[model samples]
Target: MTCPRCDAATIAFSIPAALRAHLPDDRPGAALCTHCLTVTPLDDPPDDTPSFERVSDAFPANDEAAVAFACVLALLDSLVLYRAELDAVATYAETHGADVLRALERLDADDGVDAHFDVARRTRQLEQFI
Candidate 1:
């Protein structure tokens, strides 16, 4: 799978045990973006949806696809901040961080501002990485 925000390659598995209780059990979990630090629900396009098919590979690789994905991530981040869902952002970052996931996980295990601060800092860090 790929991140809905950054088009960065990722994997979507079952939601973590810690987070399951907070999410909808009926829906399967989606991948979290390591770059944009956003979590998105899986959204599969129809087989006949040619407009969504931009590559021959199992995952998208085209430049257009990358840009679109990144834009989506940015929009999603803005929405989350606007809604003041800091915990959601922290969870997403914790689930997907390349090296800091563990630290984020620890911090998010309880109610605090550290995770939120880290999420904001890391998100800005990713803008440079991109």
Candidate 2:
């Protein structure tokens, strides 16, 4: 699903059972934006939505830094879904120079083979944005 705020692809995250009770009855779940880190309520949950994934529940939902970290991880986990945000990330990296790429390198190093491949593929795609 696309993020309502940034038009970037979103990751489907099931709301924790503990938190579900607190949301309006009509809200089925939530989606996290790969780029802007916006958490949007979903009226109809997606079929592939994960059930309380670690990254979704690892940190408090209100923590901005944690959410951004989670979103980055999620983005790398499935770059195909988060592909649209790569341009935004690449743009920021260009503006900031090597530091941003260094941070991404750190993240890529910690991830699995798929993430490495995705990063490599997306790095090539970033050239178009540049």
Candidate 3:
């Protein structure tokens, strides 16, 4: 990972924090852009950093995104299938929202996913309804 501040290659690392469920709020997925001193993630980066840590805004691995997606699926005023799809994502996150978000933050920051959001494959049925 390249730190926009120092323009250095960084890697994924973790910190000690509380896990409400399986995820830790203080130790969100992050990378060091400036000599391992600057760590940030897709969800919320440090206040000082100006440039984007993640390549894309839509983090597929982001639990927040997943939560958001699930919420969208649940809240979208669409057909039954749309509700079902969002409900599925919401359900999946409801149980493991924390840990999944942690993992997702790592993937999103690392650019491990090819596309922005992979829900297209998972929520294909939504197309027909929309």
**Highest lDDT model number:** 2
For model 2, how does the per-residue alpha-carbon lDDT over 1-130 read when each residue is reduced to its tens digit? 8877668766675443433443333255667655444566777666553432232333322433333333333344445555565444434333433333444444444422123235545444544443
Candidate 1 segments whose C-alpha is farther than 4 A from its true place: 16-18, 24-26, 43-102, 105-130
As for model 3, its CA RMSD to the true structure in angstroms is 12.4
Q: What TM-score against the true fold does each predicted structure earn? A: 0.32, 0.35, 0.23
Candidate 2 at 63: error in angstroms? 17
List ranges where model 3 is wrong by over 4 Å: 15-27, 34-36, 42-130
Sort by TM-score, top down from the best: 2, 1, 3
Clashing pairs in 1: 5-69, 5-73
Candidate 1 lDDT over 77-128, as tens digits, reads 3443323333443334334432233333332343322221354454444443
Clashing pairs in 2: none
Q: Give the range where candidate 2 is weakest over 10 consecutive residues by summed lDDT.
A: 52-61
TM-score of 2: 0.35
Whole-structure CA lDDT of model 2 = 0.45
Taken over the whole model, the C-alpha lDDT of each candidate is 0.36, 0.45, 0.38
Give the C-alpha miss distance for residue 103 in model 2, angstroms: 15
What TM-score does structure 1 among the candidates reach?
0.32
